[model samples]
Target: MQLLLPSDVVRKMRKHMFRAQRREIGGMIMGEQIADQQFRILDFSVDATSGTRSKFVRDAEQHDLVLKEFFERTGKEYHRFNYLGEWHTHPGFSVDPSLQDIYAMQDLVDGTGGVDFAVLLISRLRWFWQYDCSASLFLRDHQPVRVNIKREDPNAKTEGEL
Candidate 1:
């Protein structure tokens, strides 16, 4: 299946993705809801490889924990919230799943519902022929699905505190 993304959201994703690349850290986000899709991005998180986090970072290990917790927490946040997928950054102008990425995708599928989720990859910069920060989806059947990445502003206020 193909994913459709708004032009503006793609632009914003590129901006943050580059920031992560420069910091040598991985970026994460909640992919916006598609027009008629039944799923939504519950929350987003990032693990940077620069500054304090970079000193001793293990994204692969840490990501497992993060994903686990997120799944548990979001399951309670809303009855419909669930682990949709994952997004990471690639320090390049073109964002494509490398061999390692593909392996990771397979691992995620093996561990979870697989293609029922998505793994978004972003580039450090935009290229005329590359996807700066784009979303790719996978199916439990090991089919590759494309999702249109969208940009969304984080909520600046907290619940009941706003």
Candidate 2:
């Protein structure tokens, strides 16, 4: 399975990553899940919070409301969009999943019944979070799935450019 993230959304994440700098900041990815093979991330939510340098906990309090707002702002075609999953930054480190990361993914999957799939997007950034962030994706308990931010982005090049 693969995920498609649009260019604007990628840019937004990069901006957030830069602002967070050495701290962890995260949000939810909102989009439609197409069949069992492809998913599209059309929008996101960045809840303002003072995250720590090592961990980020999404503000679930604002998650649903933010999603509803996005759903209304977009064309009717995106009304069916649901929670795709979460994304966080791992500043100056590999995007590999830590043991805690794995458990958090598992916990999310378990908390939501019928969620056959879930996403955990980890991005490793350079100094000052400049340049395109190194990204890794995990779908459910599966191995890391490569993220194709967008075909149009010149910096979409990565290990798995699917």
Candidate 3:
């Protein structure tokens, strides 16, 4: 299924990935959409101190703190933004949601009503994966619909802009 994200948001995500590559590290952000489906990216956060080998550590207390602070600071930026969820990366392979990922997803579901969001995974193979969706009883927990993407060709510029 095709994802219905705003064109501007997609562009910014692409741009962020490029920057992440330059620093040899992964990045993450939070976003939300109103009931009408209008998307707003609230804030971008990352553990820049960690690199490709960044451990997918499973620390409940630490995770809670991160999520809490994230919400407290930026939850009010949008008319309807909440702790919509997080994004992270993988050193290799497609950024498929792993088992640990599912657990984290479940935490979000239990903590916040039942909101869906995006998770981005950048691969060392020069590809990126985007997962977007919500949680449901019939669906697997933290299941993200993946969108494989390619960058705009610089040589084939669009319209009057670069």
lDDT of each prediction vs. the true structure? 0.50, 0.67, 0.45
**Predictions ranked by lDDT, top down?**
2, 1, 3
Worst 10 residues of 1 by lDDT: 153-162
How well is each residue in 1-162 modelled by candidate 3, as lDDT tens digits? 221244454455555555555333433345555446434444544554444444443333545566567667764555455443455555443445666665655555555535444444433325453422222121235454554232333354542211
Candidate 2 wrongly placed segments (more than 4 Å): 34-36, 74-80, 112-114, 129-162
Error of 2 at 157 (Å): 13
Taking all chains together, each candidate's TM-score versus the true structure is: 0.55, 0.75, 0.46
Q: For residues 90-126, could you state the per-residue lDDT of candidate 1 as single tens digits?
A: 5532466665566666666766534446565444454
Name the best candidate (by TM-score).
Answer: 2
Go through the candidates in order and give the clash count of each.
9, 0, 0
Better of 2 and 3 by TM-score: 2
Instruction: Using TM-score, rank the candidates from best to worst.
Output: 2, 1, 3
Superposed Cα deviation of residue 106, candidate 2 (Å): 0.5
**Number of backbone clashes in candidate 3:** 0
Kindly report which residue stretches of model 3 are placed more than 4 angstroms away from their true locations once superposed: 1-28, 32-38, 51-54, 57-79, 111-162
